[model samples]
Target: MWGGDRLDNYVEQLRKERGLNQEEFAKAIRVSRQTVSAIENGKYNPSLDLAFIISDFFGKTIEEIFIYKGGADK
Candidate 1:
């Protein structure tokens, strides 16, 4: 299982704060808008490199943007 729900991010909020739409944000980060949507929706987990890119884009640490909820049911 992917355990996507275990991962959380502030991508959408941050992007909006920066006045960037999904397509614009995706282009800035070299990913498809669909990928950005998935990240925001918690339907997909990004690779470490992409995560680093996103963190850098937001001027935040990876931990500040993406939070791991850990294994299911403790």
Candidate 2:
């Protein structure tokens, strides 16, 4: 479920840090701008493949970008 409210990401921050807009970042990651927007807004959970792609594009690990805040529930 991508944790809904429990999921957090640094996509927007990283994209801005790299001076790339949503469209540019989406293109770099081979995804639609809307998809990027969804991920940035925390309304969508990326597939494992997409996660790898994004992480690779930013030279980071999936855990570095997507954080699960529901760990406290366990």
Best by TM-score: 1
**Candidate 2 regions off by >4 Å?**
1-3, 71-74
Error of 1 at 36 (Å): 0.4
lDDT of each: 0.92, 0.90
Q: Per-residue lDDT for 12-72 in model 1, tens only?
A: 9999999999999999999999999988988889999999999999999999999998887
Candidate 2 residue pairs that clash? none
Using lDDT, give the best candidate's number: 1
Q: Tell me model 1's lDDT, rounded to 2 decimals.
A: 0.92
Per-residue lDDT value at 18 in model 1:
97
Q: Tell me each candidate's TM-score.
A: 0.90, 0.88
Model 1, residue 67: distance off in Å is: 0.6
How far residue 17's Cα lies from its native spot in candidate 2, in Å, is: 0.3
Expressed as tens digits, the lDDT of each residue in 1-74 for candidate 2 is 64378779999999999999999999888889999999999999898899899999999999999998875545
